[model samples]
Target chain A: MVSRIGKEIELSPVEMASRYSSRALYNLAAGSPDPSTIPVGEIMNSYDRVLSDLGPRALGYPGAGGQESLVKEIENFLPFLGLSIRKGERLVVTSGAQHAIELIAKYLLENEVVVAENPTFVETLTPMKLRSSVVLPVSLDERGMSVDELESLTRTVKVSIVYIIPNCHNPAGVTTCLERRKRLAELAEERNFYILEDDPYRPISTGVPPPVKSFDNNGRVIYVSTFSKILAPGLRIGFILANQEVAEKLALLEQNDFSTSTINQYVVADLLKRGVIQGRTEQLSSHYGRKMKILVESLRENRLDDFNPPSCGFFLLLNLHKDADSVFHTALTKGLLFVPAGPFFLRGGETYARLSVAVAQEEHIVKGVRVLKEVLSQD
Target chain B: MVSRIGKEIELSPVEMASRYSSRALYNLAAGSPDPSTIPVGEIMNSYDRVLSDLGPRALGYPGAGGQESLVKEIENFLPFLGLSIRKGERLVVTSGAQHAIELIAKYLLENEVVVAENPTFVETLTPMKLRSSVVLPVSLDERGMSVDELESLTRTVKVSIVYIIPNCHNPAGVTTCLERRKRLAELAEERNFYILEDDPYRPISTGVPPPVKSFDNNGRVIYVSTFSKILAPGLRIGFILANQEVAEKLALLEQNDFSTSTINQYVVADLLKRGVIQGRTEQLSSHYGRKMKILVESLRENRLDDFNPPSCGFFLLLNLHKDADSVFHTALTKGLLFVPAGPFFLRGGETYARLSVAVAQEEHIVKGVRVLKEVLSQD
Candidate 1:
């Protein structure tokens, strides 16, 4: 008796991800944080400290929104990371950034039209699609999502939400320029639509502009980000920064999960109290930055595929100029792993493939590119 | 553009619950497990060990359904607790029992008819209501939710799901008899409806009959249970046992949360591997058993109100024979907290209140009843 959702989880990309075995393959396919950058010792200490301090309360339901100490830490740290709740806005802790997207899609979408980039993260779009939202895919340019296209699309059909990555877009790592961020906010204000600014990659993405939310004077931008990129994905800590009304609605909706792991929240709170998150995020930014640079340099040196080198963040998309299926399969058999682009879009991207430098070391990045060149040349 | 959820979170019941202060008030209104029963040392050791061993993977995504070690532990422990996921069955770990319910309601309820016990747990109903399901409240007799009413209701409307708290039912704390369990399963097979056997209180509840899921041969029953009663809720671990197809579908749905806490899962897994849960649960069963007995005896001794003594589990519903509003208010001022019945029902529960003995000590139970007696006599 399942209610048939409009979109289903595509196994092709996931299968590509699985092919990237940890010790076996030249893995450039995962979006996971760099293992070296995770604050293992500090996280261990924080867990011990939180468990000892909070005792049983750490394992209980953390109130309506979240644990007070954790919320305060988030508020204290967000501004330094270029997010600000300010005046009438509030926040709610979530399981992860995906859970944040699910809340907005499940409660606020109302089956209205949503706009996303042509080649975007499928994970971000799945929950929105599950809510039966009519999706309009907008293409990205050098500046990011074309505001002119979004403005034109709004005239044709009523758009309720516009989901934007803004910084280090998945599959296609394109950072929105400051002008585009402001323009996106302006468009949301003019259209009376909400801008779901998904900023999961921002903290680890180098030189990110202020969030679209900063430009949203009319409270049309809902900011969502996660600790997955900077801290650890397994921690499953993400938060939504929205207007108090919407935040309250989300908090009430979050009651559905009982609460995101209270112990996890408290541990994160302990880390934040010690100011570990800031130093760790800076370390992650540089670690991923160096890896992204190595990947780009090797790809350029080989001159195997047509792609723009991303300034920062985990992923870069290669335009294979033809179907990437043969290239992907041949590369996989050769012990190199990168995701095919078919699953990252509403319809197209058959001629593209996404390469991730998130978990790859400098050697793997260079070696992975050499293998990709061999596969591409043969294809 | 927030979707107007049909049932807004009832503040009244939540407000009644909130009136329970931790340190000062005699908290007979909470479903929280006793802090004394929490295996703090074991959990702390487990977390430290899992993190030290697994390193970065401990804090990364636990994969599709859950962490492998945790799922295996669930597979092992469930049968010991009288829940058997035999051939063709599968399980997916959730954030909590509430998350398991949310998944079913959001994905399966297609706004179809749902039958729940009269004065059911509101947190469970809130998610179902959000999915626009037409909920039909069925009253409970000694055995549990009246199967006759359920059978009659199914004849008129297509009942998609019947949510049952089989063992130590919340609010009422009524255990469905073994015959009733078999009958519920048979009714589901005949009706082509699903039975969501919510058994959060089973491990601690004394003399619980085998679950309705155990009686089903047709794969029509989905079992939902949690570690909150036996362990700590702040860990936020719960699971669902269903047919492989449904389990896969639910796992696909769970991709929205990225994953439940990986660290928490590993910690729980470590504890399970060490067989800490078996001993801990037995201790909890006896500890809570004594508390329930004391509360019932004290109430009977004082002749405070009308209530059938619960054999086990956390709660007991007292029939006040009059509206409990004034009595509740007066009791609260005199340092007592018990949840008023208004919030537990679909419509009417004015003459009742649900008392919980989960966290209270023997002294608090006796003193709470005396307070109740004084409040009742004043009214």
Candidate 2:
């Protein structure tokens, strides 16, 4: 007998594309990098050295509480983000930021109200919704999650958790300002609700902003960051920082989920410990910075539609005259791909589409924008 | 505010250990292999080669379904376990087998009756309970999940899922016979319940037995396996083979989570394709086999406990006379560590404990068993 839930799941956009399209069809949709551009050689070298020290078991099940060296290194890494958590108090290595998010949902949100930005990364919403938590979307503008809206909403919704992308917000690439971050932290403290600060796109930019964790005094903010964007995503390495209470809950959740790859954490920790990641971050920021410039300048030159490139992260939100889904479908035929912002919105999302600058090369940027110009001009 | 569910959320014994004990004190409670044992050097070689060929993008967000070559390798690897599904039918590469198990719980079991062996793996039971699935524990003997009990239960309860350890059962180390596998498969077909054939330890045993998936002609078996035990768990690479309907549903669930680490998959596929894993498996089997024998025979010679060395896998189930928790706690004081078997049980699991012989060296096994014997002799 087929499961009714099973029948409801639509095939993912990535899988469908693999069947119809040929040869890595410009994947701006899934918010992944152009694989050819990531620095695999250096990572492999670091992996080689780490494996030589750790051996085969490094690849086996990681420690239930994460490897000590990695946790310690992460502890060291957190200070740079403006949070000072000891390895034991606040750090955990997860399979990905998604796992960390899910753990927080499982541990903290118990059929309670979860406030998320209206147009947000859909994956972040999965854990909360799956847990049967009442999801209340707070509308976001170019300044990230609107604090005023959140403040107003929390007063009524009895919010259990607030999921925010403080840095270069996904699908919208809007970084929250320091004042907003402080106000949001204040609201979370006042409401006595936990804040899940997801900042996966942090290292790709030169500009440093105060994290929610930086403002957290009562240990309410659980900061989640990933090496996936900076080092690589396939490593499945992400860590969360919170108080011991939250870390313990996450540790318990991870204990059941199977701890993240042990060696992946080791390899990453070794890289972080040895300053390999910091060294590479310089190259990564420059690369994304150049790509962001290329995308913004090209869109302006072509005058495709009203669009603004934010200061950081991988994507830009384009204000489209036509429906985002129709533009996405038509652009596929013309070999230009981008995520239609319609799917990002839980409430109503019709006028905008999200384009990733991470994978768009200079040549592709020129060609893609021209294609977008032609396709939009036709309609 | 503390979550109402947070206070209510149950944790496995290992999870409790992670929470209560210091990291050093919690060593033996967790069943994950020591990170020091992973074959990092060999995997790093593959990582280097892959990186040279593809670069950093390989580690970025993976193809939503899975990496193509890695999925193909997994497809190739599956026939050995008696599963013959098409390339894209119902196979998904997950973060780990643990994640795959949770995915099944999410999609298949909807508070429906699930039958697992008593003294089961905690990770398996955690997700089932988390989903509020009605869990019924079948008894286990030296031959694995008691088929007669399972058959009788399947007939009575409206069973939707049955999780089995066809090779070497975790905690139990009992390998079910081929006849029982066929019986289990027939029961699944008869009752229309899915069999979750978890075989992480299958590759570790030189003495291969018939798997339920091999006998699964009716497509009721969703076979799961991982390189975690054999290669590296930290790679967090595992696969689930089911029919097209089941596979597609799991794929959507995975897309919601982080897609399997792409670069890890590529390196794993390379290891498989290049014959590295095959060579490593032989070495591993021989090495862990010797360690297993030493631990078993020593236990017999010392008359320390009533336990059998696992026929295959890396673990041994000890049925102790004293309180299993106290016995384990005392052993840790003696600087000897092993997982207490209480957490493995679905229902009654207080009297048993699991010791992994895989990681303990031959000399350490002799010394460890001597310590265990002394501990048992005390009082």
Candidate 3:
């Protein structure tokens, strides 16, 4: 009874991560924030105050985009991430960054060709893939998605969209440099295609450059970011900054999901109001930074292919350069869980493994690395 | 660059309601609940307790379906609405009942022919229309959507699905009779077509017979209901009770939206756990009941064509028996507002108006009806 698109739907990485988080003693898979970093008491207080102060007003219909106060807060917060809302631009709040991508993919892409990093985040990629006729993946260098290849490909294929994770690129951990960001923005304008600059990890990711959207003179870049990384995924708050016309159109599509949860907006808005998020942001940076450090050091000390650690955010990806399937099975028996990077790529990532430290304690990260080393040495 | 489906998306009734609720002095348009009865303090308490108790755990990634506690709560609460989760039946929580419709419409529906009531809830119908090749409208009688017409429809058209708003029908406040419900269930089985029993207002609706799902021996009926009407739309919580296979399929589709807000789920589960919703249910019935009474009485006392009031839920549709365009315009000029029934019907409903008492207080309901009566009498 399901449709063709429905049949094509697979278990997303987020779902796989959730399973690993629960089942594994040493969970190195999920990108979910470490529970310790979430400001529980602050969130609770903000929610209490919002519910009490707004009464039923908070729970009533939030109209099209979102709670007005939250929208303003989001606008204010965007500048901190080196993004500014330009004239003739507006914002639409979505359930999450993933939802923002779904709206763009389903509404904007007309079964046309899409371009993304070769190892893209398929959680977002699946929606775009299902909607579009084809997704052409560009190779990634140290500076992020290779716009040079994208520029070359644009000669043959009329690309409708270019989706990129600018900071701490998933499965590759390459931040787009400033030079590349400007070139990508220029490429988008020249090609008359949209650039979906997906930047969910910016708050936690270090050594970030200005987002590609920041450089776009035209309204070609749609900046998608979320509270899930900084605040909590349970908050399910995200927004997209786009041209006013595009934002209005996406808001119409958003009516189908009704609106993002009213209570959540109030809480997040209140959290911003009370300046709780900044503190939470620092806490997250330190928390994830410490874990990433331990994992990278363990990898180095154990002489497992020497690589620099991701500056911040979740876990770093490892290019196993060996058969991933057997290693994965062997590790599964020992209860050390890590996400295989093959699913993150639309094509050609069969041997890579993404090891997330989002849920792992330091000891587990150390021990999990030891197990990975032993597993790799057996080959 | 927008897709055809995106181009076809319209401003839904929920969006329209949000606009009217904000702009109108006396809103007789929005189906949003009366602010006075929303159990604000109770919700505040529940939210506070849940956050304090669950803390970071509440804000983490909820797996595919929903928070386990909330699912159990929803399951326990199902019996009160004359629905039950039978053996081999499962549930998947959604952002809202509107969202449930979108999921089923998008994932389950192919470009097949769909059947809905002539004057159906377009908020839900729009998604179905966008997905399906055609939507055949069945006539509605005093006993709700005419089962005989649906039976005839199946003969002429190979109907893939039959959609119905079973209780306190959105524009027509009639409930389905048990006999018709049984026959519809049987027809669905005999014809091998799915039945989407949309029952958002079931908790507040009165004189509702056992739902069509109750009569189904086979899993032909997918029950969609929400906490929006009974609790608040701000909660943005709803669920679909379907066969395990069907539920699993829908859950996989849900991974796209990620999951419904975890905090909202925790708050709702807490409300259910504390039995606050039962008190809130009684509160809503009496509160809406009084406003509805005032609106109905004013309509009759002013010698407007007499009509029966909806037993409960948000609004009652008046067969304006006049050019609805002029009536609506005149009412607008006089600072009174109501929904024109034109958009509610896919076919014809040119002269009807739907008057809601959901948001208006008793005095406003009385005054709004007076203005509406004067506008109608001028003809």
lDDT (tens digit, per residue) of candidate 3 on B45-83: 887788878889889876668778999998899888787
lDDT of 1 by residue, B12-81 (tens): 3643466467533688887888887887878888888988998998887666677878999999998776
**Which numbered prediction scores highest in lDDT against the true structure?**
3
Q: What is the DockQ of candidate 3?
A: 0.75
Predicted candidate 3 versus true structure: per-residue lDDT over A1-379, tens digit per residue? 6786788888876576566555577888878888887878888788778877888888976566877899998888887788888999999989888788888887887678999898888788888888889998898876778889999999889999999988877766667778988999999988999999899888876457888888989999999999898889988889999999888888888777774888788888888777777556666777888888899888889887634357666757687877666677788777778888888877777788888878789999999988888888884
Give the TM-score comparing model 3 with the true structure, all chains together.
Answer: 0.97
Candidate 3 residue runs with Cα over 4 Å from true position: A306-308, B306-309
Recovered native contacts, candidate 2: 0.63
Q: Return whichever of 2 and 3 wins on TM-score.
A: 3
Residue A219 shift from truth in candidate 3, angstroms: 1.0
User: Chain A: TM-score in each candidate?
Assistant: 0.95, 0.92, 0.96
DockQ pick, better of 1 and 3: 3
Q: The CA-based lDDT of model 2 is what?
A: 0.74
In model 2, the runs with Cα more than 4 Å from the true position are: A1-30, A34-37, A86-89, A280-283, B1-41, B86-89, B280-286, B304-309, B347-349
